[model samples]
Target chain A: MDLTFAPEEEAFRAECRAWLEANVPRGLPSGDTRDGFGVHLEWERALYGARYAVVSWPEEYGGRGASAMEWLIFEEEYYRVGGPQRVTQNGIFLLAPTVFEFGTQEQKDRILPRMAAAEDLWCQGWSEPNAGSDLAGIQSKAVRDDAGGGWRLSGQKTWTTRGAFCTHLFGLFRSDPEAERHRGLTYFLVPLDAPGMTVRGFGRLDGDEGFAEVFLDDVFVPDTDVLGEVHQGWGVAMATTSSERGLTLRSPGRFTATAARLIELRRERADPHDTRLRDAVIRAWTDAEAYRWQTFLTVTRMSAGEQLGAESSMTKVFWSDLDVRMHELALELLGADAEHDDSGWMKGYQFALSGPIYAGTNEIQRNVIAERVLGLPRK
Target chain B: MQFAFTDDQLAFRDAVRDLLARECPPSVVRDAWTNKHGRTDTLWTRLGEMGVLGAALELTDLDLVLVFEESGYFAVPEPIVEHVAVAVPLLPEPTRAATGAITAVTSLEGQGAVAYGNSADVVVAGSDAGVELLEAFEVTTLPNSVDGSRRLGQVSSSGTGSGVQIGDRDVFRRAFDRGALGTAAQLIGLTRRMLDMTVAYVSDRNQFGVPVGSFQAVKHHLADARIALEFARPLVYRAAWSMSEEDPDASVHVSMAKAAAGDAANLTAAKALQCHGAIGYSYEYDLHLFMKRAWALAAAWGDASWHRSRVGRAIL
Candidate 1:
């Protein structure tokens, strides 16, 4: 198998490298401060302006319509140049894919471009306080209006990432009260600014308002806002969660960049006799390289039109575990200063802790692997 | 970038798999454990005739990788990995039959052990003057390996005129790296087989009036094994790719692959054995055959700790 990219792909990489080098912001603000979030939004706008925001999307969706290989190269270059994390990830990665897959042409024409441009930041509304791992257990409800014009939603969605500043929320709501779990649910696109809707910001473990509690009280949603077929939200939601846990949420390039940083940090250490730390550093790098190659294989399959099945759960379990381990090793290598929250390693370690819990727990992913991939009998 | 084998490579692998299925099945593996010299000469000759022995020199990198992986999957008693991946690349033309070498100085010293020291016509041994090929007939053999089918033992040249020097320091180092890569690929293949066997046994074997595979405990073990192999498989190929291209960081990638694959294979073996209950530990069963082979190969070229330190040295 050939590892090197074709000449045209190489040229695409060069183009990405040049654009990222010229346009990437310097000394970008970090954390959940208003100013920092605003700067990230502006950066997303700048990316959209250059058509580098969603390189793998269709041209009509305000993307370059690049190949999977080009997208991988873009991701590699984006991380290599220390590109900022996408503030619009929920919209651009999770909901946008679902919209493209399940939304009507009218929805696509109206929604994707705005989402791509970051004009309407989106937050997920999947997990409620009681429905963390068992997402189908969510109690959120939406009822059709008596006049048959719209639906009124009433629910509280916790762990809503970027809910504090996001303009919209996409979620699964119970449309039929009599129907059982995962059967009567309907996916909806709701405006956070709708009447009776409120977002209560809360501090994460790292003292950032990256996630919040979104409360919807009799919020009216038009019929046109329904994402997919009525009572088919479970299937639509799977598409979103799969994309969240799969390639888009944790790309190999991100881990590669982090592993490179860890290596740099290790090299900066004066003492080289710490074999424990040394081995950990190498393990981090090895796992990252493995993930990169594995993603290349997955990309090859995708290019050949092969759908990723339970393998996405395996990827989620692997990358999330690796992320936690890598960050833990980084903190250990940072010595006593690792205790400080201001240190980037400590912050990273805090964030990595949430990876396995979100999207889906590793325990659930393992169950998925056991049942679907290995053909094990379900309990 | 493509990460899959070409059509020719797949066909070659299928051929190897078919041949191994017929000639090197579980019964043959079990027989070799009890058989004298533990050498399957007929199978080795057939492989040689198929050009599997000279594949490293004759085939592309991907083809050789596929062959090595298949050899590991079948746990072929012959030293095809040693002959093709390590010894063949460095030796001159007109290579003798079924070369088995020990470039690791530890395996050579103290007891002066070398794998297949008896069956190999020419045994390459590492010494202070680099690597040299010694005529097996001239050296005395002391048999007994932990893996019964391996036929490993100590070999003493005894002033057989210091043997014939075939490669120097750099060549020896590259040989060791290739050895590690081959071992890594074998570990991956063996581990994959272990995983499949465990899945089949668990699905069919019942306990407490239900199939044990239905239990979350059993499923989790297999799931972890699958995940480990999935991640490690790519590293093996990447390392092989690096070595084939003679990349500057080839050594580092080789160390990473070996370390990752060794750890993955060892873990898979443990879980597979645990899942198989007491039957897995029996000699009559085929499970122990792979277990022994994995144990032998895990520490063959370089163990996990050794490779980890090498990678650490490069990166840190």
Candidate 2:
């Protein structure tokens, strides 16, 4: 087992660190807000210009076609220099992989470059009022409009992160009403400005307009917008969810950076006598290190042609739980000052709360692990 | 970075696993509890014949860790960690070739008891001064351990002509790290065994006319255990890699692995016992064999808290 990066990988890391150190904007607001979203879009454009936006994607698709190990190194370097969260993640990390895997030449040509450049911001339109955990219970309908050579979408999608700002959405709709849960659904890429569609921004727990409820009333999406086979959206969507829950969405770099920052905070504010809090900080740091190594193992397996299936569920449970615990420890270190502090720990804690709930809840992921990974009987 | 074992390493692991499965079953482990000296001579010789005892002489820490993990999987009642990981590597070339002679090592200062002390033909002790190979030692057997096969005892130099000075302080320090890394690998194996046993029990055992595994609570419990072990395993492997490479941060990495594996094993033991209900609590059940081994190992080299504190000093 070789844990040390090769000279080329280290060189790539050095380049990424230098670029991110110089280019990352100072004092940018949270990307969830309107002002912050615009600034974040500018950063994404800069990243794309440097060919660092989608390092793992093919070169033709505005990426360097970097290896998975290189991509992880890029992430580590990016976060080490305090790079902001990628506001374009829904399109770049989640939907882009699916599109590359299943999208036609036309879709790939029209979608990827713009998504990488943040010219066409996208949001996930999966969870609805009744379909948060049971994603297959989507009530959205896509009726064939033969005359218009398109589909007429009618549905309401809630908890659409940054939907108010995104120009388009990638979601699921029932194309075959007769087919029950998990079947009949077709993946659709709908423009937010499509006729009869409205996005209503709402306050999340953090009191930011980070979420929206998209109401679709007879919105027309042409056949070209369909992703994957019309009725096999479940399989396509699973691929995307796996990306969301696994490597791409949350890199170990993010947690390890947060862990480093937490250590700094402890050094600055922690009570020396509070051994419990000290221990908590240590556990948080080690957990981050553990996650970093785990990701390396996973990337190694993936590079060796192994497919990651239900095991991704274990990844989700671990990092999400670690994220929450790390933030909690940070806040405890801050003590009473945490309540009104603008140090981002409070905001990060609020965001971490959504990790376990989103990307399919931890409970659902555990069921997947037990039944699929462990071969436990499901009654 | 290739963070996986090579094909040769995996082959070695599988070979050891097969050997342990056949030679070191639960009955063999049970026998260690009542057997004189708590030693399985036949299994030891077989392992020696397999070149497992001479592993440190020919293999990297990365390769030897895989063997230690398999030994823990079978709950092999031997001083494999002490002999293979610590004592064997530090022993003189002549002494290292004597694979039949069982060796055990202990820290001279804080260690209260040495595992397999009675069975060991050579006892090595490490301290700030250096490492010493005791010529004649007296073993005072301690009380029966939670893991009956462990066989702990106090070792004192009997024919004290100040035992042979073998290695210096740096050698002892590195040996401690190797011992911890080996134990960490063992803990990961023990954790997997417990989780696997619990998953099987819950899948077959029923409650309210349905398999208890179907209950979300039971599924979540086992799932959490699996998650802990799954994540901790990479740390152990990476620690082995670091030690093999003689990385400057090897001690910190070893501490991380031991801390994580210790926590994962202890947590899995508790969840496995709870999920198995009354049957898991009984001594006759096979689950305790692994559960108790996990408990004893978790506290052996350094408990989770101690290792974490060590890690805390390094990072914080």
Candidate 3:
């Protein structure tokens, strides 16, 4: 029933708030763009130097080994000061957790420090032209080259976010031809600079070079680059996708900060008499607060050793919808000017549009919630 | 921060839940619609005996909300929120000890209809001026509500000066917040019950030679309802904690909880009815019990729009 942070947690929060307030860069470009990605990487390096890059990881891995609660507090402080979106999230949030869980000691030592320092930027390679929602329908294959002491990968992975800019990728590939759908897959860490690989950057809906199609023509990945056991990538990939969908990727502090900004925006621009818009702002703000408390409840359960499984789908559906609605309301407040303005509202609105579509479509998440959380019959 | 109930608090909730399951089933709720006093006396006594009526005096706001939520789960035909959360807390020490006495509350200046006013042993009228405990008051029963079990009445002082001033405006405001928080908890319970019934119904009933729950459309509808409840539940609990800690922002937090819980309950009821089809439309089906309770409770202390306005004033 305790809701207030402990004294030490408060001290940690104060320390984070002071550091973020002092050092968070201003006027940084969108991290999704080519020019912006480079600047964002510099910011990531600055964060790493301050030991603020991976607060929840062990100290040996360039983190403070902070608790989950402290991690949430750090996120709160980070977003409260308008910290730039983490350019290293794919490596730090999504892939790093899986690597820590499943990676061998050699893999952890090699991958983690570089990841924290943003020395080797990483992007995901999950969705393809034919395998968006049906992720297990991956057509990518990794054939063993026993004599060469490696695997030869051949596949076309589309919608590989930031793949063109990233130095490395972590993805699933079929390693056993006879096995089908979720079996016989192996997780691989591939370098974009491999001899047979080419990454073609493309414009997303927001017109940023945030999307890339990675074409692999027998690109070789050494045996040491294998993430987990052979033919166990499906299990390994599920762990990463859950992190993608859950609190690790989208903490409540992000939305609450946006909600606070929305309130300030209303105070500055909106008509005092516009009750309709006022109510909408309140709804958005209240929902954001609700998400905050819900995250607290979740972290509390996790701290108590409860496993978060299919329920993360519920969190995904909630925040993705909330993000879109909050941004939509901001646009409406901007009215006609929204179409031409560069206030980042338009950019944010465009980015929020992708929340439901990526990290598994809301439709797919709903199916997961219905079938798994509610125990509803599946077709 | 730990955002869960303690074992003792949870045990209390389970005990209340079990008692309601045995004593305050749907049939008993149905009975209230036709019963003489619009309530069953025995269950009230049982609740009082269980110290539920005195929860505000003993338990923290966090523990007290669980009782209110369980009462909502059963759709109990009693003014537990009014009597326990609002009225009893303001009573004089000796009066507070009389747990079995039914005490309803209403705004003194607004003088709106009081829930369970006609049947209550006493009515606490409150406003910025002060709080007054009325021993006997004139009561004019209002029109029958959408929820038949929820009987409202207009209360006016009979001029015998039996009304004793007990507390001041600040105390009254806190009581109002508690009432709002308790109602929010109840709305959450009602929302859960409706979603559960709809889930069970869809899982067993077949249409097009397959279980209705097998349909993606039905699954999505139910999932949306579940998502609404899941997010709303924590807000309610956090509000309880805020109130328990007497945070300076407790009023706004309570407003957030009420608004979110109200919206969740309304949305769930609509989706539950739509999924239940014609059976839910009929009074004969049990789903309407929770749906109707949700409707009344959501709009009772303050509707979603009203609470959102309160929140907007604070933040915007």
Candidate 4:
């Protein structure tokens, strides 16, 4: 029930704030969720080197192992500094945990350290052009070699995050056409430079080429490269995908930053005629704070080791959609000023518009809440 | 950090829920907007007696829980939050411990009868003036293109009512936050109910090919409604939770909760009505009953923009 940070945490917060004030970049992210790829990658390395990244991980793994609340303080300051998101998000957020869970001792030794240091750039190869939300629908097939050891893979996985630049790809490939939805898949770790695999780039709404259409053509993979049991790939991928409690890339406070930025954008143009716009700005203000508290509630649930359920789906869905609200208000507030992309606002607006389509579509999250969280039958 | 309500709050919530089902049923709400009198002396007296106006004020933990649940299930026809936020602080220890209103908010425009215009016994809303308790009468309805839940009406108040006027502006606005957070909680309930009602009705109702809900439009819209409700519910609770934490950043949560819940309730209520279609607009249908309450609460205390600005300033 207490909101104030303990004196120690507050002091730690001040220390971090002081550090950021000294070392962090001067300008903010221009409200564009997308950052320049080259700059973002370099920033990721610098952050990891400084140990300011991965606030929740064990210090041995290049993080501060901070308490959940302290981690939030870290994010609040990070956003205040307006630093770029960790460029190797797939490596840090998704794969590192998966490796820790299923990886062999050597695998952990080889990957975890690199992952912690951002030396391992990972791309997700789960979804295909046809498989959209249904991971089981992936037709990208992998077949066993004659020696019955390594496998040869051939298929197309699109919307592969950072596939163009990432060095490794962790993916779900159909190993047996006969196996049912949850049974026949295999999770594999394939180096991007492996023969037959090609990377093709695509543009995001942020105008960055972080996403790519990865074509897997007869790529070789040793048996040890498989993430989990054969024909049990779905289980591994599902566990990884559903690992909601681990790292929260979208901290609750991010909503606050987004809201605040909208207000700043409006304050520069503050005029009496802008009452409606001002009102929208106020709404964004409340929304950001409300959800952060809501997030605070969720964080406590997680800290108490509560199982991940439908309730947390609310945050992902709300934050993304509310983010759109802030932008829509921004667009409305800016009106004619909206077209002035030279100042980076229009780009920000477009980025917001694209948010719902990212992560999981808002529709998918609702289905999860309705069917699983609310215990309602699926339509 | 705990989600569990205190033992007293549990008992109080159960009682409030029980009382609401019997007293201000959706049917009554439906009736009032149509031909029936929305508020009666007895109804008002019962609410006062039940501690509806003062649940958060002076009641025990049990009383707070009761209002939380009440705020969820039944839509309050009056400014119960205003009563709780303004009156609870000023009530006698017995009443305050019981957690009911201690003092009333006074508004210059007075209680308009249509919830916001003159909904408070002591209007605690707005800056410049403090909680303005005025000589008030029952609400008289006016037709409008706006909300169905909030019947717009005009009222004149006697300025002689017992209440204090505020000299400082910040104090006036802070009073509104407590009420705003309370209403946002209610909006969560309303959105959930609307989603439930729409889901139940559509799942059964037949259409061109199959059950109308089987169609993608119905499913997606309901799903979207579900998403809105889910997203809003947490934010609403977050604000409430923050209030308990008494964090200065609570304003962050209050504004966020109000903004998110207001938007979600409006979206969900609209979709719920759309799903019910012809029946939704009819007087006999209960769909509009929820809609009206949602419409009224969405704009209460402050609208989306007001909340957004508070959040914006905090982070920026």
Candidate 5:
């Protein structure tokens, strides 16, 4: 029940804050635009150079090998200092865990350092035009290239986050077409530069091409590119999804910072006596603090070697919904300027709309919660 | 830092759960509704014997949190929250044993009725001078509340009995926060029970030739309720933890926990009742027992708006 940090964790936080205050790039691009995307990539490289990119990974992987609590402290300090969003998030948070868990020694030794340095920007390829929430409904296929000792991958993965700038993608493909859903799929990493591969960027709700449709037309991938056993992609992909929804993707620090900003906005622009706005502001802060406490609880358990399991679905539902509500409250506080203003609140409002839709829709997350956490029968 | 309860705390929880399972069954809860004072003296005596009533002074805040949760889960008809979380902490040790089902006075000028007011042996009210403990006979009692499990009464200032001034404003403030935090924990426990009941019912009951639980609408409703409860649980526990540590921000944390848990518990009651359909509406059903308890507890201590205002004052 203790909330106080250990001395070492506090020292680590101080170090992180000191480094961020000294080295964090100023007037950097927002990463929502094409020009800013490159600057964001460079910022990630700078983070890697400072050994602050992946705090929880092993030192060999260019991380500090910090404990989970220290990592949380790093985040708290990082966000407090107004650190830019991690541009290498897809590579660092989602895919890196899978690579560490399922990649061969050769793969880890080869890919992780490059990933940490932003030399090989990565994007996820989980959903398609037809397989949004129903991930197993993916029609992507990969056939073994016996002559070349590789596989010929052909698929169109839509909603590929950061696909416009990423040089590589890791996706699930139907390796054994004869098998039923989720059984015969294979997890593979493909280079976007491979022959016959094209990335067509799409505008997101925030009017940014951060998301793209990646088309793989018989792109050749070596056997070394396979993440895990063929026909066992679902199990491997679940690992990444859990990390995406559960741990690193939406850290409590982001919401805490956002909540602090919302309060600032209310104090600066909102009427002091407006009880409705006051209540919403308070709720936003409370929800964010609740999330922070919950994450602390989660980190403590994980530090003690506990597995999070399908309970991550509940976390996904909670933060995603809270993020949207917080953003909405920010907009409400903006009042008439909510729609027409060029404030950061407008962009955040647009971005918050996608939280529930991504990492599996809230609807799908609920089904997962109901079936796995509550032991309810599947529909 | 560890957030999970220790083995001893868990054992205490299990003991409370076992006691409630054995003594506070649905039949017994239903009987309490019809009793003269809307609660059983035996249960109160057993609680006192178990030292549950004295936990405010004896147990750590975290331990009392686990205890209060079980009280809420069982929908215990007694004024345990008022006794353990509020009165005992404000009153001195010599008077604690003499107190029977203590009720709170949030405002001296308000309706002045407290839960189980008629049954209380002690009426503790905080005022400008100090915290005062008056005998139940000192305050006029008006019975019949929305929640029938515990009797409620309106009190007036003119009573014949002399009062005992035990503590000051700070002591009373801490007791108030404890009462709110206790109610928050109870709301969370009550929400868990409501969600569990609905989950079980939806799985067994079929509609349109399929189990209703399989329907996304029903599942989503239950799922939202579950998410709310899950998120609120940590807040309640952390609030307890904060209070146990005597953190300066403990009051704010308690208010946050109360606001979140009250909103979540009310939603759980509504969703559970809606999922149960017609059967849930009947007084004969067990769902109403918890539903009524949820309504009562949500308004008790400090309601959602009251707590939210507290949070706004602190943070905003």
Candidate 6:
């Protein structure tokens, strides 16, 4: 199907382009830091204050109440200007949506405004060292703190991205040791200010300490902080992970930008009819461009409220695989220069390796396709 | 992102499956492959009558990927690609068959008689001149070593009219590209069939009181085969589609498809054979039927490395 924006949508895109031209300041801080988020927070708050908080959300909850297609245009522009990723990602992308569907009025009132303003930064607490894909195997414990009118939690959360800097975390803990693996868990919003909370940096494949190993000991939470119904954390957790899959991936246009850079790089070293070199260029272009196209399809599907089911898995698989293909081309085209470990091409190659592991590994995705889509006999 | 095949395609695929099952049945494959210098002229005529011979070729462009896919599906026991791809499509079809494989050549521009000792039945060769020299007449050639099941004959050149010759630049180029694409598609078909057969076999065959397919190692390897098949499907289809559309990118796509298809076929067929173990290599087993097809297809247009280098040269 053709993928041109509608006339009205195109007009909306132009308007957003102008607005982004006016906003999105130059020379901003990078990485996951307080200062980095400070400007990001101010920017979001300004947008939110102007009724641009949640493009697809209901106006009742600090949002523009826009259509999904319009929201897509907004996101497209955000990435176009090299705008900051949603700094309070936990609130905007994950928790708020869940809360909007399931939270009480008090929870909504107390949380929505602050989240919109970036006054609070939130990290996810899903994985323990033991429970990544087998998430129901959580080892974290949360005892009823009746005297404090809530709960006291104790646990270690690894791969807690941005945990060291974020002010809050949304987590699922084992609130009832006697309950079943999934049924016993309860979702909670925990503030880092709570006693015995510690965040320690950990190295990631990306060579950044953006992720942390967070320790929570005797951390107190008021009754109001509990999210959704107790022992039903699995459902909410799945929702969060699926949302993360949609929102956290590098934008398709990001690859477009990379492709532009590549075209420039190849220009200096290439000649027409250099078959090997030309072949490499075409392969690179196809892999990246196709994946980018496929991912854009996924985005459009999500906006249309279509459950891609295993197609979503297919998308995840495609981007990672394509990234690897692109990296291979980058290395080949670079010739002798590819040997440099610090080279951008090399870094891309290394980074592409994580693709299959995260957002569910390719093996896992294939399994999903086999079972859910292909209807292959599991045996 | 969307992998749904349309209803029309689904029906078309179903028809192909049925035809292959009945006409290109495993028994037929067994018979054809077991003998030396084998052929099924009757079946080819039947397929041609049904228009299935050109089912994959689009009228818009000389897209041959469709035909290639069918060849892969059935592991069809013929040099359909070479005939349809390299000769009929590239040169003139129904070029006069001579008593022997050899005939006289009017020009040296063609791949010299394609018939060594005996003359070639139909020799469509490329020339530097704008015109492709196609000669057809009653020609005969000496028999050569039967490398494949099909009988081998050699064709020769002399200033004679034993073989018919026609001059057409368009036909030669179209046929050449089609031949390459078709061979690639046939390999894709063969490998796909091998993988399917292996999957079905392993799922049924038991060891240690369990189906072999249930084993993790078996599943992973089968998965690998499936991956190979999938990775090349788009390549094959895109190339075919390009030819059908006569897209400027046809060569690029065709080269990739041919290269990918060759590798996938070779690797997947070998792996499938391994999964079937000793039985696969035995003469009586059905695995050889597919394997031979793969082997033949690989050598038909170009081998894997050749296509790969071509792809490299084009892209790099």
Best by DockQ: 2
lDDT tens per residue, model 3, B194-254 = 9889989999999899999989899999999999999999999998999989999998999
Q: Supply candidate 4's per-residue lDDT for A264.
A: 81
Error of 2 at B266 (Å): 0.1
Candidate 5 global CA lDDT score: 0.83
Tally clashes: model 3: 0
lDDT string for model 4 (A1-379, tens) is 4444688788879988987778776544421123555566666777778787676777877888888788888888877766555667777777776777787877877777787776777888887898886767889988999695889999999888778877899999889988867678899999999999899987776666757999988999998888878888877776566543222646766668777777787777667456666666666665566566666666667777986665555566767778778777777767786777455457666766756665667677666655565444454
Scored against the true structure, residue B235 in model 4 reaches a CA lDDT of: 66
Order the candidate numbers by DockQ, best to worst.
Answer: 2, 3, 5, 1, 4, 6
DockQ-based CAPRI category assigned to the predicted complex of candidate 4 = acceptable
**Worst window of 10 by summed lDDT in candidate 6 chain B:** B97-106
Candidate RMSDs in order: 3.0, 1.3, 1.5, 5.0, 2.1, 6.6
lDDT of 6 by residue, B46-100 (tens): 6565555444333322334454577667866655555444444333433322111
Q: State which docking tier applies to candidate 1.
A: medium
Which order, best to worst by lDDT? 3, 2, 5, 1, 4, 6
Range of the 10 consecutive residues with the lowest summed lDDT in candidate 3 chain B: B103-112
Q: What lDDT score is found at residue B37 in candidate 3?
A: 77
lDDT tens digits, residue span B1-316, model 1: 8887778988998999899988998788888888887867478778877877777767655567877888889888877777777776656553544222222112222122467766666656664457776653343555566679887666666554666778787666777777778888889889988988999999899899888999988888989999999899988898888888888898888888988898998999999999999999887889989988998898878788888888877766
Superior candidate under TM-score, 1 versus 3: 3
lDDT of 2 by residue, A1-379 (tens): 7888899999999999888898988778888998889988888998999999999999998899899989999999898888988999999999999999999999999999899888999999999899989999999999999998989999999999999999999999999999999999999999999999999999899988999999999999999999999989999999998999998899999999999999999999988777898889999998988889999999889989999888899999999999999998889888899999798899999999999999999999999998998888889
Give the CA lDDT, 0 to 100, for residue B295 in model 4: 76
Which segments of candidate 3 are over 4 A away from where they belong? Answer: B93-98, B101-112
Q: What docking grade does candidate 3 earn?
A: high
Better of 1 and 3 by lDDT: 3
> How would you encode candidate 5's per-residue C-alpha lDDT over B1-316 as one tens digit per residue?
7778888899988988888888898788888889887886577767766767776666888988988998888888887777777776666543444244344433222112577766656567765456777753444555566677767665544466546777777777777787789889999889988988889998999888888898888888888898888888899999999999999999999999999999999999999999888988987889988988898888877788888998888887
Write down the TM-score for model 4.
0.82
- Give the distance in Å from residue B251's predicted Cα in candidate 1 to where it truly belongs: 2.6
What's candidate 6's i-RMS value? 5.2
